[model samples]
Target: MARVPAGADLELDVQLEGVAEGVLVTASVVAPLAGDCARCLEPFTSVMQVRFQELFAPESAEPADADEQDAVESYPLDGSGQLDLEPALRDALVLELPLSPLCEDDCKGLCPECGVRLADAEPGHEHEQRGAMWAALKNYRAAGPEGSSAGEEAVPDGKAGPERTTDRTDTAPGQAGT
Candidate 1:
């Protein structure tokens, strides 16, 4: 077992089959990692297990095959000709980490209207009021004196007369006192 820089552990166990030209590596991996959840902004820990088989091309291949041979890697063999499995097992485990993690099944996020934390909201918490501009307009329509219309005269349908005056007052500004 070997420890990586960020506290990840790598372990490898394998049986290497050496052919006339190349070596095959089979191994298992274990990894422990930490990440922040995307939705809830909480930390989470996870363990990942991976297993893989890698074919290692030999170093003595022809010069014309160098480009294709460079694409593959050859594992170093011990004095007894057994393949070392450490490097490949570590690589596979690191690739298995989640790009984005989620902390819980239901993460109530921040409120869009008020930017408050939705998960921590009170049972009947009312929203903040910025002062209702149209409060007088609404109150005027409700609960006026009974049988009293607010000067909205009903025009008789069959009668002909001058058009109803929409302007509340015709008094000139400076002549009102006289």
Candidate 2:
């Protein structure tokens, strides 16, 4: 039916028999499914055969017991004793449909970094490693305020520069421990 999400075409080969309380409908449903593979995004098609048997109770009939009512699952027939098979067929086929259809058993899928399909990629396909962008900020902090080289004092002969202060008492205004 058109309700099938993956564009599947359904055909039902059905037989009906009258029972004591209802009509028993038996069918072999054949559906041709077409959709993309979940992992590889490749298109695929397959035939699915589902065997279904459901009891459609007459509209005037009532359950003999509460327990029987709870245990037995049956669809209701129309006032004229005609069964609408759409709901039963829809539920049966949908439940049998695959949650994630795959083109192959071992699909590698697409690369997260490059979006290239892994199956078609080279033997050692890889991207260059990128350093963190914040690393430059850390290097700048190590350099003095006047733009000295990292890890080296601004003054010559390894002496601490005027910008480099060891004394905590000489803190900048509004800073703690002044």
Winner by lDDT: 2
RMSD of each: 10.9, 10.9
Candidate 1 per-residue lDDT over residues 74-93, each given as its tens digit: 55444555555656665676
**lDDT tens string, model 2, 1-178?**
2224455457889999999868899989998766677887877776678889998886556456678777767888878756799888888988887778766668788888888888889977776444343566667665645565433443442465443464423665438644
**Which parts of model 1 have CA positions greater than 4 angstroms off?**
1-8, 11-13, 62-64, 70-82, 104-178
Clashes per candidate (backbone, < 3 Å): 0, 0
Error of 2 at 99 (Å): 1.2
Collision pairs in model 1: none
TM-score of every prediction relative to native:
0.48, 0.57
lDDT of 2: 0.73
